[model samples]
Target: MADIHITIHNKTFATATEPTIADFTLSLVSGEFVCLVGASGCGKTTLLNIIADLDYDYDGDIVVGQQHKSPKIGYIFQNPRLLPWRTVRENIELALPDDYAGDVVDNLLDIMQLTPHQHVYADRLSLGMGRRVSIIRAFAVNPELLLMDEPFVSLDPPTARQVRALLLQLWQQRPHTVLFVTHDLREAITLADKLIFLSANPMQIISEVLVAIPRNERNNELAVENFRQQLLNEHPDIKQLL
Candidate 1:
C-alpha cells in the first residue's frame, strides 16, 4: 500500500488558451477508496491520465509511496480495451510480470465469476463481461495504486448493478489505493470512502465529502438514498456539481 501526493502547477493544451488544471493539489491515503466526480469533459480523465503516467506534458509532481518510491499502477479505462483476438485469460496474463504465478489470475477469475468464460475471446464477450476481464486484469497485477475511469458506464441497470457488486467484492478482498472517476452521484455515494467534486472549467476540486455510510450499508438503496439526501441537505451548493 502507498500513499500518493499530486501537485499540478498547470496543464494546458497547445491549442487552448487557458490551462485545464492550475495549482491543484490532492492526496490519497494508503488503501483508501476515493472517487472524483464532476460534469462531463471537466478534465477528470485527464487527471487520471496524469496520475497513471500515461500523459506527462503537464508541469506537476506526483509522489507515490514512501520516499517517492514508484508503485505499480493499474488503470481501468471506460472501455475494456482488451484485444479482440485474445482470450480473457490471455488478455489478463498480458499484464502479469514474468515471475508472477498463474494461480493469481485463476483466483481473480473465479472471484469475478469469470472462470467459466476465461477461455472466451474478448470479441465475443458482452460489455459487462469485458469490463469484468479488465477489472480482473488490473487486480491481477496487485497494484498499489488503481485508477478507474467510469468503468461502469453505458451498461443496463441489472448488468451495472452486478458489476458494481463484483467490483466492491474485489476491492474489499484487496484494498488498493483507488482513484475512481465517475459522473454518477449515486454510484459515487455507494462506492467511495470519500467523494471529491470538481468544478466545470479549469478542473479544480470544489468540495470534498466524506461518506458517512458504513461499508456494509452502502449497498442498501435506502441507506444510500438517506445519505445522499443528507449530503445535499447540508451542502446544497454541491448539488449542481453532482
Candidate 2:
C-alpha cells in the first residue's frame, strides 16, 4: 500500500461571505481508516468534497500519491444512490470498468453478500440490503481511496452495527484508504484507526487521536467503552451535539 499525504494550507471556501472551512491541514496514510467528526455546520462534507476533487475552487494543494495523478475515488453518500430501474447486480455492475464488467460484478456480489438479492430491484430491497448494494457498487471499481459521508446513517441501531461489521470485514479484505465522515463517536471509534475532531463553522482540525487497540480486539465491549471515555476526556469537544 502507498502512503497518501493531504495538506490543506490556507484553504477557504465560502458562499457569499460565509466561510465553510479555513486553514485546514491534515495528513492521512494509505490503508488507514480515518473518520472526521464534527458539528452540523463544521464543513465535514465540504472537506470531503475537496479531497474527492469534487470541489476544487478552494485555495490549497490536495495531493495524493507520488505521481500526483488523480487517484480513483469512490464516494458513498447518506442515501443509497442506486438506480431505481436497475437490479441489485446491475447497480453494482455500473461501477465496474466497461471491459471487465462480468467478472467484477460477480466477485463483488459474492463479497458483499448480495448474491441472493442479485436480481432484485432497488425499490424492492430493504434499507440494509440497499446499503449493501451501494457499498458493493462503490467497491466494484477498486478505488484507491473511498470517501463515505454517513453511509449507514439511515439504518436502525442493529442494522447499523451489522453494516459496520460488514464494512470492516470488506475493508480488511481489500485494504483501501478510507475517509468516513460521521457525527457518531462510537461509530468513528469502532471503524477508524485514526480519528479527527473538527470545530464548528469555518471548520479546522482541532485534534487527532490514534486508536492503538488492535482491530480484532475492538469488539470487546468493556475495552471499547473505556477507549471511548478516554477520547471524550482528551477531546471534550466531542461531547457537543452535532
Candidate 3:
C-alpha cells in the first residue's frame, strides 16, 4: 500500500491556448479506493497517466509511498493492450518485476477464473476475457498503487458486473491504493470509498463525497440507490458538476 500526493501547478500543451490542469492537488491514502468521475474528454485519463509516470511533460509533483521513493505502479487501460502472440499466463508473467519474488501468475489466473484459458493466445480471447487477463497482469506485479481508467467500459452489463465483483474481491485481499476513473456514477458509488467529482474546461475536482455505506452493503441496489438519493438531496449543487 502507498500514499499518493499529486499537485499539478500548470499542465498545458504547446498548441493549446490554456492549461489543462492548473493548481490542482489531490491526495490518496494508503489502501483507499478513490474514484474520479467526470465527463468525456476531461483530463481524467491524463491525470492517471501522470500519476503512473507515463506522462512527465506536465508541471506537477507526484510522490508515492512513505519514503518518497518511486513505487511500483500497475495500470489498466480501457483496452487490454495485450500482445497477440503471448498466451494469457505469459502475458501476466511478463508484468512481473525482475527482482520480484514468488509466482502470483497461477494464483491470479485461478482466482480470475482464467485457468482454462491460460494457454490460449491473447488474440483469441473475448473482450471480457482479455480484460480479466489485463487485470491479472496488473495485480501480478503486486503494485503498491493501481491506476485503472475505465477498465470495464464497452463491456456488456453482466460481464461488467462480473468483472467488477472479481476486481473488488482481489482488491479486498490485497488492499492496493487505487485511483479508478469512471464516467458511471453508479459504478463509482459501488466501487469507491470516496467519490471525487470533476469538472471539465481545465479539469479540477469540484466535489467529493464519502461512501458512508459499508462495503458489504454496497452490493445492495436499494441501499446504493438510497445513498445516491441522499447525496443528491444533501448536495444539490453537485449535480451541476457531474
- Residue-wise C-alpha lDDT for candidate 3, range 19-63, written one tens digit per residue: 888889999899999999888877999888777777888887877
**Clashes (candidate 3):** 0
In TM-score terms, candidate 2 sits at 0.92
Candidate with top TM-score is: 1
TM-score of each: 0.96, 0.92, 0.94
Candidate 2, residue 149: lDDT:
94
Q: Taking the tens digit of each residue's C-alpha lDDT, what string does model 2 give over 1-242? A: 56666655544554346566767777779888999988776778877787788888777775666766456888898889888899998887777766865876777677777788899999999999888888877877788888999999889999998888888888887788898999987888889999888886567888888987788877776778889888788767778834
Worst 10 residues of 1 by lDDT: 63-72
lDDT string, candidate 1, 197-222, tens digits: 89856989888999988889887999
Q: What TM-score does candidate 1 get on C-alpha atoms?
A: 0.96
Clashes of 2: 0
- For model 3, which pairs clash? none
lDDT of each: 0.89, 0.81, 0.86
Best by lDDT: 1
User: Residue 73 deviation, candidate 2, in Å?
Assistant: 0.5
